[model samples]
Target: MSFLNTLNLTGKDKSVGLLLGLILLSHTERTGAKDKSNVVQKGKGSTAKLKEIMIGRCFNYLGTINPNAGNKDCSKLWEAFLRAFSEKDPCKITKEDYKPFLNMADHDIPIGQSIFWSQTKELILQYTDVTHKVMPLENTLIGFMLDGLNWCGKLSSPGPNYEACPEWNSCTNHSMGSFWRAASENYAMKAQGEVTVLLNGSANAFRENSIFREIELGKLDSKRVTSVHLWIMDNIDGPDKESCGVGSVAVLENILKEKKIKYTCVDNYKPVKMLQCVFKLDRPSCNTGT
Candidate 1:
């Protein structure tokens, strides 16, 4: 028996089967094309997820303090948690939101003291890059700083962490780049992030000492600088040294304004024991080399 006749179907039935086969072939082709287009989109989505995973893992690893504070196992768990809850609402406030604050006036109620927002931005950037990879610098400074101080537990209480060590006055502690990066990355809502001016010794006498040093060292160029946060530290050893004085504030403000540099002075605010300040510069317009 011939293959066509073996089925014992009518001529109409044969034609119907042939038509169905053609339809199936066409459908297969269309499905394949759709899948090909989706491949590119899928790859992009996968890459974004992978980047997030890498950053979160690295950040967790660097932030680890004690032998058990954050282990590799803890990081894996944290990663899973973040992935599950990764859908952050755009309305939620983030650290970068402080960039606009430089434009706000000094007397602006809440904005006047919002030092944490910008600082957190600096911290985040330091830890994660555009690809979300954890940078080594985060490991060295923030990690070491946290680890040495025992961070959360140590800084929380008035123990050795509160002790006024000579290290606080050193370049490492006062470095703008390090401070900026750490501040930008810190995500804690409770962190003071407020700029504090420690006016010790003669407040007016050496109010501009740090600023002058920065300028002399060619770190700060008056015209190129857009704004600067002032931290006036004086007589750190004196009995009443911790008090933020009025004279320092007046002198620093007058000098900064006279230089045509938009600025804000945050005095007597101590998030931690350290006196902190922030400075903003117009990168493109800055005559000073970055």
Candidate 2:
């Protein structure tokens, strides 16, 4: 048995013991020879800080951003989220664990405006910000609060590990992956009228195992979804890898068609491409004002 188990420590005992071990290890590392290469990366702590950020964003969503967003209590939402993975093995957290949390965070997505993208996230961000006429998952309340953050909990305690969370590839039910899967599934289930996806023509835009393909596509309801639109964009100077009715684009179209869904694919969509050229306006291709 481990030292903690030998002592019959439980609950707070084990938590404090673990924290002390981390502090001692840090001191030892500091006292030893400096080695930047040996630096350790850590997942975000699920503590007051993460809670504060979540709550703040929740209130912002209900107030400043979209006052019409469904009624929700930020504190209770945090409790539901905490109840999802707390005291569970990080690698064993299934998407189902977050169902309660997703239920609580649910809000209506504006009709025909949900934007899904793969491999071209930054481009989509610029596109959505410039247009503000579309809504990416990242713009939603849950995604807004947790974007770029990592969190995981432990089976041995009721609180988060605050040390190292499992890497997404470590298991099929990885904590972070589970959360996104549940969120993406929830988002897809709520999509209405029209759906839009942004894809990079330079790369394999359609990955078989992406969240968009795995969770989102299958969950889309034909009765509720009217059409799907694919914006296949390539860099200004390009070895174009894919486009409408070509390459993986063909694969995506086939998938949607097999589902009896209507779609439109545009290659290097002009408005988004124009945003890309903002930084390189002096380029020959960008100098079109004759």
Report the lDDT tens digits of candidate 1 across residue range 1-290: 64346556676898876666678789999977754432222111212233344445445544552232232343443243233213322112233432222112011112123221111224333323332332222332223222222100011222121122222223332212233333333321211223322233323423334433232212323544445555333322323332222544555566656656565654322332121222223323222341
lDDT computed for candidate 1:
0.33
**Per-residue lDDT of candidate 2, residues 1-290 (tens digit):** 67567667789899987777778788878755332211222444444467787888889888887777778899999899888888776767888899888888878899998889888889898988888888888888878767877777776567666666656676788788989998998889889898998988888878888889888989988889999989998866666888899987899899899989999999878888899899988766566661
Q: What's each prediction's TM-score?
A: 0.25, 0.81
Among the numbered candidates, top TM-score falls to 2
Best by lDDT: 2
lDDT of 2: 0.81
RMSD of 1: 19.9
TM-score of 2: 0.81
Clashes of each: 18, 0
